[model samples]
Target: MSGASIRAPYDNPMDRHLATTSASPTLVTGAAGFIGFHVVRKLLQRGAAVVGVDNLNAYYDPALKEARLALLRGADGFSFHQIDLSQRDATARLFAETRPETVIHLAAQAGVRYSLTHPESYVDSNLVGFGNVLEGCRHNGTQHLVYASSSSVYGANTHMPFSVHHNVDHPVSLYAATKKANELMAHCYSHLYGLATTGLRFFTVYGPWGRPDMALFKFTRAILAGEPIDVYNNGNMRRDFTYVDDVAEGVVRTAALTASANPAWGGDAPDPATSAAPYRLYNIGNTEPVDLMTMIGVLERALGREAQKRYLPIQPGDVPATWADVDALVQDTGYRPATPLEDGIAAFVAWYRDYYRA
Candidate 1:
């Protein structure tokens, strides 16, 4: 899709709902991370008191995470906690003390490639940490729990524009498996404890203050430094590269509109996205899928430099393509991720040059 096509203004119908709920404190895990930082800022902008939680692990770079936190620290309605959610006691204490009515669980050991080398980290953070979060929300009077799920959950499924209703039984990577597990874990809580939970499967989110391991960040760094960038799958990939701001908007909107049990959901042929319980799943992404080469071309234009690309075989935990079917998200919240890839990349490049003095 062209950049001009997606630069349209967003019209969110959930503005009134968000304004009404903005006074309450919301617990946001991984608040120092890419998506987390953006989400917290959006909440704060809407006059919401945000309790930010992050361990500040060395998954990529602690300096970057800390930098993100510094900006958030200056905000009026923002508070930070440097605690590892994987620690059961620490997590429990956090929930008890904060007593947050709403929770946005975005903390996880992110990165598909990293998960391959350190499977234990994924188990600890994604699985155990998520369990503790579920327990905390279950015990505390958390009215709504909106957590980050990933497009990786649609593993080994060759479906175009992946839908939430698809049965994702086969996850190709451990990271994908853990994400899928989170959805199931959430469903159990929603069914048994009557907790309202909504899972958002985000697709290739990129922008300013993004993760270093992500394509946009790495590519920008390598290109500016005159280094070679490893282009996996021989650049034969298409990603639904949703902008961070768009994703943050969707998350806040979704959180305001709490999940509810689908009355039409029956046992005979159940829908995976919605349940008989107060659980729901939605794909939060740009509906447009851009080619990897096309994305590189855009990045080159933004950076004013050409990347030295080294083509390579598809990685073990990698997918050739990913496209999100965001119809459900629009239908529910009246919000769509319409940020153009060109604009998003340009914004990221500008931030990169400013931050790195490149």
Candidate 2:
């Protein structure tokens, strides 16, 4: 802790520290997707060399993701490669070529409903693909590896404001199971290979350029198209609707720092989210739970039309509510979601109208 060198888990770390503006090349998987696109753009704005990878699969509208990529292509020192995480050979080659010192793993088979229909995609992208990424980091001397986990890991828990210290052993869906598996796998790598890993358990993130599968995006489209927007759980559910910008800020802050084992970490009275190795888990969410009906009302006001709503019971693999307790994230990285749901919804509606020319 004496020298000007940044705190690294290992003595001979491979991280490119800023001795005199020593910025390392960073890799972002799923760079064309909602959260990934925002994180990459923010990194570029901060004068970081960024390499983006996305399979550009037709799971959603590839054209929309392509447009996001198009906007990102003009930046200097920013590169994009169309590759699937499941393709071990191709992913390994890219990692070898980039020689990235830090990686953000965001490319996973997303959506609760989609996982039920196509479970293989979740296994392909979240489990196998994640293992390949770990293998690359282990050999390439990666200093810091940050990956996305989900709040859905708190399945069947009636706990308000889910904390990383709590146990998350039970998962409802294939998607949540894989996300939980990611944390376990990352812990294993950190324990064995000394990889500084941080897993971010994100809540219901929403904002501009959001995913079409999310409730905000789908409700906006349906409301504008003069169709009924489905209100799940009979509009009684609650969610910590975090803004995407806030999420990006948290991700950037977390990436700049490496996880370390707490010196006083206990084994018998263990925290499920941290380890004796250089590994940590954090919950990134708004902390403020907004009711489902309240969110729809905000959308209605933004669109200037009452949504024809069809209320239904909670679907399979859907959680009733989610609230993130971000105390540890704030302590470690000064990270917390700040956007209010009303303002965020309005901003999203504005972006949706302009982006789609509605």
Candidate 3:
């Protein structure tokens, strides 16, 4: 492999050498987001320079995004750019200017139900934005690209403990479809450009600074305000709710260990999780699935209040259960999300109360 061309801030050979010798600075897209924010925090704490980019879209709350950015700004070795990934020209310029060595592409239009009504948003952000990220990595000297995928890709598959090797051709919603499309797009880049890419199929991620639309946050807010919380699937729905920090740790570890072609890969009996190219996929989750009612109970315990529950039928584009099989993640990265639900809830509740003054 040829040496990457160094841009400004690293134009000097000595400076470039020093920067490259240690862990290379990572460009984290969606840096103001939930998982992205945590990933950036972890990367900065590890003494790695982080170039974070976020559009700060008002999909949920821009204020929350700014709050996450504020904390990151205070940290050392952290820089931020408020750029929209969906803009091809701007994204291209960002890559040319930064010439990042590694990229964590976590920006996306993220909600399964929301996708039903807002398909165009998914098309713009997940499809077009992801295309820009891939182009940036390919044109620049990005060594590894770690992007977020979702367990929703296992749509209509009733299998327990969803595995990465299983086929994900069926996606129930545009959100899931876009995530699956990301994996395909990354593979194309890897096969064509030798871009080492890893797609993480995250389960129901919950904790501090999570998206307001997510169950945990909604439940917490409603319960605290003495409002009735919507219990979907008659509270029978289950989720493998992985903690934010654990997900961040796994992402860091995976990023450090760049994807590589599987020597054992054979086209005759191809493994969906790995390829002859430097492309791979893994399921990042807590492995333990908890029912919706159980999660509410945990939240109630954490908040010291009982939730007025309004049980409802399962909604469209929603799955009844989601469980992840993380053996492959464990075998490869030597890591698995192990945060106890109770502990995770407690931490999130603490942060929410403090952040919202509730």
Predicted model with the maximum lDDT: 1
Clash count list over all predictions: 0, 0, 0
Cα error, residue 213 of model 1, in Å, equals 0.5
**Model 2, range 265-342, lDDT digits (tens) per residue?**
789898887878999999999999989999999889989999998989999999989999999999987666889888
Measured over all alpha carbons after superposition, the RMSD of each candidate to the real structure, in angstroms, is 4.7, 5.8, 6.0
State model 1's lDDT.
0.90
Query: Candidate 2 versus the native: TM-score?
Result: 0.94
Off by over 4 Å in 2: 1-23
How close to the true structure is residue 17 of candidate 2, measured as C-alpha lDDT?
Answer: 34
Clashes of 3: 0
Candidate 3: tens digits of C-alpha lDDT, residues 1-358:
0011111232222223323444556899999999999988776655568899999999998999998888777566778899999999999999999988888899999999899999999999999999999999999898889999999999999978799989888888889999999999999999999999999999999999999999999999999999999998899899999999999888878887789999999999989999999999999999999988899999999999999999899999999999999999999878878999999999999999999999
* Model 2 / residue 13 / CA error / Å: 21
All candidates: TM-score: 0.95, 0.94, 0.94
Least accurate 10 contiguous residues by lDDT in model 2: 11-20
Error of 2 at 192 (Å): 0.5
Alpha carbon deviation, residue 338, candidate 2 (Å): 1.0
